[model samples]
Target: MAESEHSSSENASMDSIEEHSKQDSELEFSDDEETLIIRMFNLVGERWSLIAGRIPGRTAEEIEKYWNTRYSTSQ
Candidate 1:
């Protein structure tokens, strides 16, 4: 039905928006940034907002996620 098709289209648009929002929140790290995060993590012990402030251009939530994904287990 046309209504069903319209609803599906709306769902697809919403999905695309969600995906874009997730991508926007993801921050890319340079080698220096990675080193800084590791060092700060050692110094502060998962105090991500402080570490993020030291790194520049990254949110605390993003830094926490990145550290958890990439480095948490190693330390």
Candidate 2:
């Protein structure tokens, strides 16, 4: 019973960490970055790596997720 309780606590801690990371990943982009991302996305299309490279301090995956979540027509 003690071990089970410990395991549950660990799982809860892990879930909180995961939730924080998800929130961090959904970072706010500056106006310039937003404009650049939109323009590059339009010109190059979902080419996230290329777009991320053009923007400082952002990853391809993050940009892709942000665009998909906030701007993608399919969403």
Candidate 3:
């Protein structure tokens, strides 16, 4: 019973840490970054790594996700 309680506490702590990391990883692009991403998309077309390289402090995956969320049409 005591071991089970300790395990549950550890699990809760891990859950909190994971949630915090998810929040931290969320994309918060500035106006300039958004404009740059759009212009880069027009120039390069889904070349997320290339676009991300041009934008400071952004990852390819994050930029791709942002593009998809903002631009992709649901079917």
lDDT, candidates in the order shown: 0.85, 0.89, 0.91
lDDT of 2 at 34: 90
Query: Between candidates 2 and 3, which one is better according to TM-score?
Result: 3
Task: Please give the lDDT score at residue 23 for candidate 2.
Answer: 73
lDDT of 3 by residue, 44-72 (tens): 99999999999978889999988888889
Clashing pairs in 1: none
Residue pairs clashing in model 3 are none
lDDT winner among the candidates?
3
Cα miss at 27, model 2 (Å)?
Answer: 2.6
Better of 1 and 2 by lDDT: 2
Clashing pairs in 2: none
Best-fitting candidate, measured by TM-score?
3
Tens-digit lDDT track for model 2 on 19-58?
9988775667888989999999889998999999998789
Off by over 4 Å in 1: 1-25
TM-score of each: 0.68, 0.69, 0.71
| Model 2: per-residue Cα lDDT at residue 64 | 89
Q: What is the lDDT of residue 13 in candidate 1?
A: 100
Candidate 1 overall lDDT versus native: 0.85
